[model samples]
Target: MDVLNPEQFRALGYRAIDMIAQQLADLADGPTRRPVPLDVRHSLEDQPIPETGADPFDLLDRVQNEVLAYPMGNPSPRFFAWVNSTPTPIGILGDLFAAAMSPSAAGGDQAATYVERAALTWVKDMLGFPQEAQGLFVSGGSKANLTCLAVMRHVMSEGKVRADGMASIDAPMIVYTSAHGHSCIEKAISALGIGSKNLRIIPVDSQHRMDVEKLREAIAADRAAGLHPVCVAASAGTTNTGAIDQLDVIADLCEAENMWFHIDGAYGGFGILAEQTEGMYKGMNRADSIAVDPHKWLYIPVECGCAIVRHAEAMRATFSLVPAYLQEDRAEPWFSEYGLQQTRGFRALKVWLSIQHYGLDGYRKMITQDINTAYELRRKLFARSDYEVVTAGPLSVTCFRYVPAGVPEEQLDDLQRQIVAWTNASARAFITTTMIDGKTVVRACHVNFRTTSADLDVLLDTLTEAGQLVLQGAQQA
Candidate 1:
């Protein structure tokens, strides 16, 4: 017998829908638990680790009361700690439908074909890539980058790669990335059996963007030693600073060096949807491959990412392994031939539904609002003498540090740590600490669609208050 009867399933669905709707509609008043409550979190492990099944009603109730009530934090209006991990109505419903439908998208002619094709085309075009671009739905940015780079390795070796292994290549092929680039590049290189030594970490300019000259020089030196610079990764937006690398400059360099250019636009690719910053991603069309997170920017739930290739042939060359069962007679083979997925989810459904429900105009307005709020925070941050902004932000992410006059830049860590700790403990807002230029600094990324000026104000106010308390305690001691 089914553990969840028809009636029980209906009730469970309604209950979950209501809980999510209420959370979104009343997000302004929602208490984002910044510092996770250790005591009330006892029920988190109340369930049996490997229970075969459970009563649907009881499970739903427990989830509503225990899990939802005390989540560490969700990206909503009150959340500004990390980049937007917000949820959209259409996307949530689309995820539900996807689970219910269970359409396997691994080039199956019967399941998830049209929607996946549309989603792939949309992403390809949206990033100035060609409509013929092919890719696969992956876990997220890191996985997406790994998959693309793996293909880069395979292609650079000219399809003799997996057959002959890394030793097949004559010279030591190096993959170069900027110091400010996403850490995923390094991880990808390591995962692909390309030693970390092959993954060169190039330096960045003052703005944290990758230095083109350094890249050229590095490639030249590698060439002098007969080292093949097979691939170069450019960042659309870095995770720590949200700074976009100069794609145009890097693209030119890659062309001159005859290297495969991959752009990691997991965070900043969505900016292409916004009108004002649309041109910033101009040179992405020339890239051999690009990775972007539909989950992060499209406001879908987690674990949806794509890696699009400029030429569908390149993708096929990278990953087409004809399985006896999946083999179909075709000149080019199926979409499954590209990248590292055999049976993929209907991940495209959530993103496609969200985009259709809210047109480009709606997304543009939302992005504009987010950008405006960031600038507002910048103004407020600079108003006080104790605070200083590290740089003018190009996107919603603002990197600033709590700096007190006459204090050594090195000691700012102690004070910044206290401020972040207090703000998180207060349950008003949350942020993360990062070391910028060898000095500890605070990072506030504004990506939530529901966030407003008032929430950001609470974060700033709480920061100053925390600083004051720390200073007072220091005086007393």
Candidate 2:
């Protein structure tokens, strides 16, 4: 087999970089979301497995033209349907370098392992975690939540879980979370053999924060029924309306009840970097563990999520099973002992590089800008009689619906759904819709730093036009 020479490699790499740079530079000219051409998929599927190696430059060109051209549109500034961030240029470069190095960050006294530790430590400091707190990066928020819940199960079970499975427990271990909490918590519980039935979905207050009184009542009722209340999972920023559960009150309740406290801060955890939103995250440091995603708010490349635990030893105790062949006499910590994966990639490089390039102060500015923009959008929407502000503030998320005066309550839900479908299909801008307090509403999350006040204005204008068209069609019919 023949490999590309150094000159050929450099030439191909330069072309790839140029293509990416051009794409980023002209982002506004492209549609926020577009369907991939059917021929593109057919071209790949219709081809047989190559018996001989193809020209490296030709393969690279195909990837640049076919694969990189069409994406889910998270990189576009106008893409606001989900909690997605536009990747920073420095972060992209870091990812490229990491891919070239191809280092397995699992363990064993290597630079990649050390880099991961340092990046996690930086994250802890950024989130105001205790000095002794330990963390590891995982695939994303789902796996991060799973990792923390696994540790919580071990610690709450008093280490018996490691020796014996869930059957060893006397009472049924139950976990509690608000209705606004991410579905990952329930998934993690079910995957751990805790059963979804053991998970309690507490109610939320008018502001969408977890109802402290209801939570207290539920815990008491559970204990009275002879059930074991093990953990309380709180949300720093819910995906639906960006409501933050009363963290301080939840922490107090957990302290009194001796239940493990975990915060799923996947989408909005990095909001703590902004000064305006810092107070909202009070008592978050009191959490026993936190799951946060750098890909959402930190503007890093995808597939970077972090799990931090107050008790590092507990995490190791929960996941440290090494065969004799993989044993080593190293004094440094082995990352594989802290999480589920035995083989890991260089996930730290992009995170560390992004942080270094854009310092904490820089990130704070971007986060504050996004938060301010969301609030401004809310204020503007509230001024309109047709728009009802369902939830706003506390974070960079706003949920509202366009309600014209004479529209019947029964027809409002369908009208809102039609508006969303029209706006998405038009592709001027993309915003998602969700149910809030039994009413359908449009939801916008300002996670991308590139999104500006002007963009928000354009979004509102486009939405208004779409809403009018839907209403007019409904009236005509």
Candidate 3:
């Protein structure tokens, strides 16, 4: 086997960097999303596996021309459809360095392991978690949620389930979360052998925050019915409306009931950095565990999430399973003993580098900007007679619909769908739609630091034009 000489490697690396920088500079020249043409797709699919190695520079050029030409537009400032952030340029460079190193961060006496541990520590501090808390980076929100729930199950079962499995428990355990909570929670429950039927869907108040009184009543009813209530999953920032549940009240209830309190802060956990939104997460420190995504709000590259647990020993107990061949005589704790993956990638490098590049103060400014943008968009929507605000916000999400007066209620949903299609087709901006309180409404989330007030104006203007066109088409029919 042969490797490129240092001189050749440096040349290729510099070219790749230049190519990416040029693309970033020209991002505004293209649409947020461009579907690959059928011919291009077919050509890509029909390519046969090569028996001989090709020139590395040629392969890189082909990838740049064919693959990078089309993207989902998550990095674009105009992309407000979902809770995706525009990756910071520094973070992108950190990703390249991590890939070059290719360290298996599962655990060992290696520099990568220490780097990951330090990154996780910074995350704990950033989120106001106790210094004694332990955490590990995982793939993303879904896996982060799963890792937290697994520990909750292990501790709640008194460590019996670790060896005997779910069959060891005689009674079914119950989990509680709001109706607007992410579906990933239910999926975690099902995967953990806890029936989805056992997961109680609690109601939310007018602002979409979880109703604490209802939650208490549900817990009482479950206790009366002889079902073991194990945990309560609270949402720091819900996906639909960016609703932050009443964390303080819920934390009190969890303490009184002796139930595990888990906070799903995948998209909103970093909101704590913004002074204006800090109060919303007042009791988050009391949570037994929190699942947060660095990729979403931290402006890091994708496939990075953190799962922090209050009790470090409990996490180790739940996940540690040292095989004979894998045994090491090191005093330092291995990260593999704290999470699900045994062969983890160097995800922490990007996080560590990004945080260092933009200190806490810088992050606070960016997050505050996003929150202010959300409020600004809501104010604009309220000013319009054709738009109806489904949810009001200080958070980084606003849900509304384009409803001209006298439009039949039955036609509103279809009109909203048409407006979204028109926006996507026009390529002026990207926004999504969701059902809020049984009414279809357009949802815009401001997580990209690059997004601006002008983008929001464009979004509103485009939505207005789309709505008018949709109504005209309906009348012509």
Candidate 4:
């Protein structure tokens, strides 16, 4: 029997939509407020599975009251914690429609397959990448990095790694990346059986960009040691400081070395849209592969990333394994042939809808606004003698610390962390801390289109209040 009649389903759906709309309207107020009481939270934790069927409406009520009422504060304009972006309204609706359609994006001449192709084309066009490049919408940056690096492994092995496994390679394949590179690169190396030890962590200069001279030295040293240099994974924008590596220089090195060049642009690739980053991403289009996250910059809902490879056939050969039962005679290659996942979700719908909702020019303006606001925070921090600017934008991330005159040198790092905790607990705004050059500092990333200078002010105010309380408590202790 049907769980609910069509008319009943329509009514329930409307109710659910209304609930979501209301939540969105109220999202800005107390964006980080802890709504649930401690007792109620304990009760929720102690919940037991129901032994019997419950009314659908009752379940919906629980979802609205218990779950939706509490949020992670990512939607708030003042949420300057990580790289998370507030989801666009159009993207949100696209997610709902995609789920309803429920098409496995594995390939075949289907609607979702075409939508995904078009979406990937849009991504390439938007990023100034070649339209001929092959791409796949993945879960997030982690999978995107893994997929591209896998192709690098296979290609560097001359396709023998796929058939004969890692044992086929005689020399140890070495991968080089900056110490500030995302941890996912090392994880991908380890996962591909390349061994993390073979991954060289090149040091960065004062600006946090990968030092080109040091990289060249490392490659030469590896060659002298009889290790095979496979690839160099450079960061378009590092997560901790938004520092972009010297891409054009790195590209030149990779070309001279005859190595695969991969750019991890997952967090700040889209920063290219900002006018201030005019020449920052130079030679990025020449990379053998690039990983990017539309969810971070395009305001798409979570779980959307793209891996674009210059050589489509090479990527296909790395993951294309058509079983006898799954074989299909289609002119267009299936998405399953592109990466690790066979049964992929229709992640492109939300991304496609979001890109269309805001054209490239629109995205550029919004992204520029975010970068400007981040710089504003940096300027404010610089104006105060007590606050020291650790790492400030060339993009939309700023890391700084409050160092009041008499604060103990040893306790500075601990004080910075305590300020974050106090401010977050107050629910006025949400921020985080990160280590830079062995010192803990407050970090903020501006990716939300809804965020403005006002939100930045709120963040500073909250931090100031939190800092005072932390210092007072420290003195008492």
Query: For model 1, what is the alpha-carbon lDDT of residue 131?
Result: 78
Residue 250 C-alpha lDDT in model 1: 83
lDDT against the true structure, each candidate: 0.79, 0.87, 0.89, 0.89
lDDT of 2 by residue, 134-167 (tens): 8999989999999999999999889987889988
Better of 1 and 4 by TM-score: 4
lDDT of 1 by residue, 1-477 (tens): 666677878988888888888877766876666444666566575545855776777877877777777665755565666665777788888889999988667665554777878877777766778776676778788888887888788888887777899888899889988887787888889889888889988888988888888888999999999999998999887777777889988888888878899999888878777655677776888888888888777777887988877767777777778867665634435667786777778888887888788777777777667767778889989897889898655777788888777767656788898888887777777677876787778887766777777887878888989988887787799
Error of 3 at 213 (Å): 1.0
**Candidate 4: clashing residue pairs, number:** 0
What range of 10 consecutive residues in model 1 has the weakest lDDT sum? 326-335
Each prediction's RMSD to truth: 2.1, 1.6, 1.4, 1.5
Q: In model 3, state the lDDT of residue 449.
A: 85
For candidate 4, which ten residues in a row score worst on lDDT?
26-35
Residue pairs of candidate 2 with colliding backbone atoms:
none
Model with the higher TM-score, candidate 1 or 2: 2
Q: Tell me the TM-score of each prediction against the true structure.
A: 0.95, 0.96, 0.97, 0.97
Put down candidate 4 lDDT per residue, 1-477, tens digits, no spaces.
557888998998999899888887876764565557777687678878878788889879988877776778888888888889888888998899899888888999888988898899988987789988999999888889999999999999999999899999989999999988999999999999999999999999989999889999999999999999989999999999999998888899899999999999999888889988857899899899999999888888998989999999999999998899887756878999999898888999998888888888889998888888888888888787788998876888999998998988898999899989888888878889999999999999989888877777788888888888888887898
Which sections of candidate 3 miss by over 4 Å?
A: 1-3
Compared with the true structure, model 1 gives a TM-score of 0.95
